[model samples]
Target chain A: MEPPDDAIPDRPARETLAHLRARIAPAEAASGPVLPLGAPPLDQRLPGGGLALGAPHEIAPEDVGDEAAALGFLLALLARRLAEGPGEALLVLAPGHPLPYGHGLLALGLDPGRLLFLEAGDDVEVFRALEAALQAGSLPAVAGLVAEGLPLVAGRRLQRAGAGTLLLILRPAGAGRPNGAATRWRIAAAPAARDGAANPRPRWRARLERCRNGRTGDWLMEWDGGAHRFDLPHGLAGRAPAAGGTPA
Target chain B: MPVALAAAGPGGLRLTAVDAGARALGLRPGEPLGRVRARVGSPLRILPAEPAADAAALERLCLWAQRYTPRVAPFGPGEDAFGLHLDVTGACHLHGGEAGLLDDLERRLAAGGIPARLALADTPGAAYALARFGAAARSHVPPGGTAAALAELPVAALRCDAATVIALKRLGLKRIGALARAPRAPLARRFGAALMMRLDQALGLRPEPLAPIPETARYGAARSFLDPVSRQETIVAVARALMGQIAPRLAAHGLGALALRLSLHRVDGAVKALDLGLASPGRCPDRVAGLLRLRLDRLGAALDAGFGFESIRLDVTAADRMPEAQGMLGAGPAEDGIADGTAALAEALGQRLGRPLLRLGGVASHLPERADRILPWRPGTGPAWSPAPLPPRPVLLLARSEPAEEVLALAPEGPPRRFRWRARLHRVAHAEGPERIAAEWWRADGPARDYYAVECEAGRRLWLYRSGPHAAERPAAWFVHGVFA
Candidate 1:
């Protein structure tokens, strides 16, 4: 008779909303600490003004050839985390994967002495070591390079085990499956800016493909090794580039 | 069938040992095999004697004999007979009494198909003499009766050489009783101090130390169960309890275990030993238990608990002096906390992976590949990370360089303008350097490598090098060594 007054709602609607919010409050609070990139634009875009620690993060190259770029991005993040504390970082390499050069890691502001390299026997062992290391919580950050995609159960386990540490999973491009990762990044090598110098700084087109509780965007990031910080190229300093465009 | 083992002797092939069938046929050791073959006029199984294998088996038996007493030594191949010496001074009570222990030892050895003569006595020398030439297979000599027990045995039973035995017999001192009654001065003067020393040792006059096998473990604890345990949890729990028993002894000695050995003694006398290596020397039972748990989990189905394990023993095979805990007055909690956590993690990972956690160490070498090495991670024991001013290195270095094909260069000695690597063609848009690195003169690693950092048009950077110099007879070979960010 009253045209099914569902739009007006009833007393139970308020209680349902409160219950949903109550369920989400503990999860948001349990995300643990935040590690800021020290860049205002990037940090502001993140939900907590930084990457959420104690959660799993997925990173993959945009193409097979861009693997080095993806690794560089992950190492940069690891370096930032190491700088924030006095603990070591572990890099677990799947079987048959090449090791990252020590001098290169040093150049990226990561101390080779502070990094532990564990070459796992297979993809399964890689995940096993990653989960164990994360649960140990002795390290500031743990990163693994796997050849296969992460299964859903493993992803959840990793998320659960990595409380109080940063967990990074690096896989090949297009190998990502549904997981509970807080953020998924796609990294691709970008052409160096022509600054009339013989050696230009390395650059990458880092795209935040997915963020669980934050907005996603794309940016051209330049690694300033001397300062140990990410910088925008000289020409694109203040302007926020348009989102969802082909990488230049 | 008659079975005899033959070994090459100075005169000819001689039998080293004989089985029961061969013995019944009147075949004896030290007899010529050819003579036996000609006289037997029947089929006899003659096998080559492996002295080395026999020694190894005897050594393993000595290790197995450790079940009875920690002080067990292998005696052999010399003037003395091949056998084991167990100093069961205080260990005799563990298996009832002396007679019971001897019985159990004989029964077990018999079950293993090993024909062994067991004896218990006050001294190792007396025990050896009784076991070798005694009338019974198993004999027990009462304390203070060593002289009486060894009296009936021949003088050769004192482990003297053949020449000494013959000399004594020529003097009509054939029996130990006769030798002991003879003039001590003449015997000591004629036969030297060794013969008298052996006699005195057997009579308990002189202390004869049994040089037990070099035990790897200094401290150990064992637990036996009435009902065998096969479940993984039970085994881990037993291992933890054993470790708990051993930790206090280790602490009492101010030692920490660097390596541990967990031996699961099955009901069938088979032992399954698992070794765990610690990253840092520690005596904490909980950490040891955690590592053992991980190791057992990794073993999973491979851990064959045949008829279950009746006893579990934990041994600290390798240990180091552990400093006493310093007062927490001036220590930083952050550093200590991290170090402890790291050590625990390393132990877990190491036990699970069956390898040690490694960290990269920089080496003072010009070769890129030889510049860094992965060494086992040890706290406060690696090179400090200092960034050296050097050329830009690649982020990922291939274990082996791959050859590049379809190379097109604008200049003969310049970087290639276009190249194909792994079946993919790449066009170089920007290039830097001919960073010439010469091979070490002391090394024979071919010619120098002129490395170039090339950025391909597809936005991928690569590290390429040309081996040797360009010549008319041999064109320089191009190789892709690494990838860059």
Candidate 2:
């Protein structure tokens, strides 16, 4: 039946509606599922209440010297992902990148036995291994340390291949290029809350710079190495960013 | 110009081998090189003899001759005679007949620029004598004709030593026919049982077994092309087809391939080989083909398909027993598929990169570097990962410690308050104790290290260590060993 002209949307309008629906679909249906970061404020701000599984995410240090901080954040996420499932995790180390200390990984709650490391000669090989690992969909998570940002096409390929898996791309700061990632984070080392504690937990100023179908915000996060979880500083929890952060 | 290989003997240099050009000029092997130079009024090319290289080449030829017959052995237990003996009893039928096999062998050897004298007889001794002393370059003795075949050959054709040959010549037994007719008891007593045994072996009275070279791989498949192929797709397809041929053989033996070697025989005799290792034993043709494709893609120009490849061979270099798959009654297939998928991915990546995927393991070592090890990843093979009650460790460890510059410490051997690393200055805001770790006395690696966990004002944490105590000759040096998040 013929309806009013306004009611019968035009071609461009229909396309726009479809695109909006694509963005609003449940993350579980679009990807696989959501992995809650276990932080209430952060989860409340995220669209799916957590990081989406089976999608690509980009993480980098805010400064060149803070690479260890970025790697620590990635390891925290990897440890959580491995704990959630029974499969192994693959870590592809690019050329010139140092090997992750076994004791350090153990101290951070990531089992060294559950991780496989592939040291690639260059960025090309690094991407090749990353794509292969993602496509296999055998591991629960896969991460690669790249010297520079990946091209858009390669990032999209990784995104497509990483269905039902967590794909993390770790690169140096200031090498950011446009990519098809679910979330983009920049981590920087932050001062410990306690001045003279015997062993202070690592603190990172994690900023969610970009997210698809969600909002972005900056927050000071602390990693509990003993428990392998992210935590808000004792007194700063109330001052953390709320769920009303600017939407992307 | 004539050429000869000379070796330093007891008195002087003597010719070990002479080419046809030198042989025609009456310069035979075992002649003194000085005498030959003084006698021959022409330019001569003399080079040192390489017996080792000759033996290696002969062994390779023996392996190469396996294409014609599996039973191929190098001529041995005698003087260094550069030749091979092949027993093509039942294998000759595959190449049409004995004549056809010899023709094919001769053609291939000549194509490879190898000058060969060929003969086919009933026994190894008969074949050896006929090939070395026969009038024709190629000879074929009919069945039941071994005695007649050796009748006209010289006594030396029996492969006897020089002394025995000279002694036989003095006894008027120059021909094998004359030796066979001589009184057996007297001949045996004079030349010992060895001479009589050689005659009997040649005449087929005694059985002689040929010890062929051992096959390196039990299962292999090979194909030759009329036109050399340089395209990657063709090579992959051929590899897949060859895998298909080998898969059944592996399954029949309840075995799976752990490693495979692909040899591409180029037109110029240079073989380009690619080796592939699997995370677990596997015999899937598609998986193998996929790995080959990945490797070929990575090789790209490095493969150097110079002038193309004429023959390709796939060999199962390593194999292991593969138990039959028994799926659980209620378990989902997806569970099993995941493990298979991971193995397939590892194989692909490892083959393409020419490296194995490794897993981090811990050793019972006090030294940090020695405490951690990386080994090839295998299922259920490494020690279980358990957190130890140890001091804080850094996430990233440098391959080697780099010295810190402009180090300023509060105490003589305490943590540094300020230091420059990689041109970046860091001011220590807080610090931990100096964990004294002595070197292993047995190893005598170096001086003991006093490690510290230092936090900079900028919030960057670094692991620093002092090499040794302050000394007059060698001052205590500080180096950054790792970085903490």
Assess chain B of each prediction and give its TM-score. Answer: 0.57, 0.53
**Candidate 1, residues B1-485: lDDT per residue as tens digits?**
78999999969999999999999999899999789989896779999999899889988988898999988888843435668898888998999888889889988999999988887888888888888899998888988888888888999889888999999999998899989999999889999999999899878889987789857645888888999999988888887788778777877887788889888999999999999988777777777778888998999889999899998888888888776665467862211112467777777888898756788888877778888887887766456755653567887778889999988999989999999999999999988878988757788787889999899997788999999788998688999988887
lDDT by residue (tens digit), candidate 1, A158-211: 988887787888988878899888888999998765576444668888888887
DockQ metric for all predictions: 0.53, 0.52
lDDT of 1 at B237: 80
Model 1, residue pairs in steric clash: none
Candidate 2 chain A least-lDDT 10 residues: A238-247
Collision count for each candidate, in order: 0, 0
Model 2 spans with C-alpha error above 4 angstroms = A1-31, A193-199, A238-248, B1-79, B82-217, B224-234, B265-272, B300-311, B327-339, B471-475
Top-DockQ structure, candidate number: 1
